[model samples]
Target: MREVAIIGAGMTKFGRSDLSLIEIMSEAAIRALEDAALGDQKVDSVYVANMGAARLNRQTAIASALVDQLNLFPAMAEAVENGPASGASAFKNGFQAIASGMADVVLVTGGERMREVNNLEATDFVASMSHPQAEYIYGVTLPALAGMFTRLYMDRYGVTAKHLALVAIKNHANALKNPYAHIHQAITIEGILTAPEAVVNNPYIADPLRLYDCCPVSDGAAALVLTTREIAEKLGKPIVKVGGIGQATDTHAVHERPDPTELTAVKIAAQKAFQMAGIGPQDIDVAELHDAFTILEIAESEEAGFFPKGEGHNALEQGVTSLGGKLPINPSGGLKAKGHPVGATGVAQLVELTWQLRGAAGDRQVEGAKNAFACNFGGFGNNVVTTVLMREE
Candidate 1:
């Protein structure tokens, strides 16, 4: 297989958007193409990643629409959906096309305009990813699952609400440096968890998970221009190689997992990615874990091998994961603060890493970052896609 590298990356600001799904995606794609400086080069294929446009926007054939919108009529166009991991799944498909000698230049874009519907409807649309007979029928929202998971993790690992609040505080502070992050408001532990008005300020969404613990439902888009190594070098852009990509799945129902507290899919997928990248978690300079909920960041960090099985919060408390620390996680604010546009999240994570590797991330940049990793979690813990990226010397 030929080596693949990313030449350009771009993303629309995350938050509620007035633009249509295709328009937002096209805007991101154009930004990426311009960043790549492809000039006269032709794109061989285009992949659009999205979870719910048909239900929310009442639109279909989004990939074809994006092609026409971008004036890339003859390029191969396809839509990919894998619950919340749709972005990474589409990226994997694009990577395969280039590696298999089927395409030289590929455009992978992920976008979701989830704000078109009401909050309850959007929640239900996302909940459709759950198992019909086991989860969805029981009205199991993601937060409920995360709440239960957090409770179990706390009991098993000594993580407390304070630890979870710390996660929120850290990520919120980081997001202040990110211009594209969805939530710009600064939060303090006292304000959210301990202050007299805390109960009303950060009300509990689920038993253990509060409003601040959840990622906001957002509308946004992100895009990447990927090509062969030769093409990347010729373009005179920083060569961010797609070092390794790994994916794994578990039981569809959260109750079916052998150990509910263990994110088995994240562990297996991260191991596969590390193995393929010829490195271990220790070698990762920065990482972007799936932080849809505050607990997820801690849980995924441990599962991804960044910390011991029950010690992720300890690492957080020690400042190991803070920016400018030993290893910064989520320098782009993460889903906790960056916004979780389900379809756009995975791709957005890569875009942030690409910027960090290129030394272009303004204030949130992790200095001297060479190797970066990302884990895009889907359907509770059932599906996941992990990626490793290296800045070529």
Candidate 2:
């Protein structure tokens, strides 16, 4: 396979967007192309990742509309949906197109207009991803699944409510530094968990999981321009290679797994990604985990090989995942506070890692970051996609 490099990354601020889905995507796609400074190079293919546009936004055939919106006729375009991991899955498609010598320049963009619907409607729409016969019929929402998982993991790993709150506090603080993040509020354990009336402030969304622990529904789009190494060199920018991409799936129903606490798909996909990158978790200078729920941050860290099984919360307690710590995770706030716009999140994680590798992540920049990892979890960890990037200085 030929080497591929990322030359440009762009995204709309993740929140309730006044623009339509296509407009939001156009803004991100155009910004990415402009950042690439492609000169006269024609885009070979365009891929859009979105999970809920058809139901939430009353729109379909988004990729076709996107091409026309940008006047990029004659270029191939398609839509990809893989639950919440749609963005990374679409990114993987673009990466393969370049690596397999099929295309020279591919544009991968992921976006969703989920906030267009009310909270209840949005919840129902997301719940549609559950196993239809075994789970969705009972109206199993993602938060409910996450809550059960959190409860089980806590019991097995001896994780405390304090540990979960720490994740919220850290990610919320990180979001304050991210200009494009949706939630700008900084949370504290005392305010959300320890105070006398904290219960009222952070009511339980699902048993053990509180309001602050869950990511808010958002609307946004993120884009990246991928090309051969030669194109990146010609563009005159710092080199950031797309080192590896891997994906895996688990049982559609959580109960079917031998161990619900173990994120089997995350472990398998991350291992494959590392093998392809010729690197290990310890070599990662920075990382971005899917933290749509706070406990997910803890669980995914272990599954991704950043920590031992059943010991991820210990690492969080030791500050191992902080911005100034040994392996900073989610410096862009992650989905916890950065907001999860369904399909846009997977692509956004890469955007942050790319910025960190390039030393462009202003205040949240991981010092001397060279190797980066990202885990995009989809459909309650039933599907996952992992990506690794290396910076060539």
RMSD to the true structure for each prediction, in A, is 0.7, 0.7
Q: Looking at model 2, how many pairs of residues clash?
A: 0
User: lDDT of each prediction vs. the true structure?
Assistant: 0.94, 0.94
Write one digit per residue (lDDT tens) for candidate 2, span 1-393.
989999989999999999999999999999888888899888999999999888988999999999999988888999999999999999999999999988999999999998898999999999998999999998788999999999999889999899999999999989999998999999888999999889999999998999999999999999999999988898796789998888999999998999999899999999999999999999999999999999999999999999999888999999989999999989999999999999999999999999999999999999999999999999999999999999997
Worst 10-residue lDDT window for candidate 1 reads 230-239
In candidate 2, stretches whose alpha carbon ends up further than 4 angstroms from where it belongs are none
lDDT of 2 at 262: 88
TM-score of predicted model 1? 0.99
Superposed Cα deviation of residue 364, candidate 1 (Å): 0.7
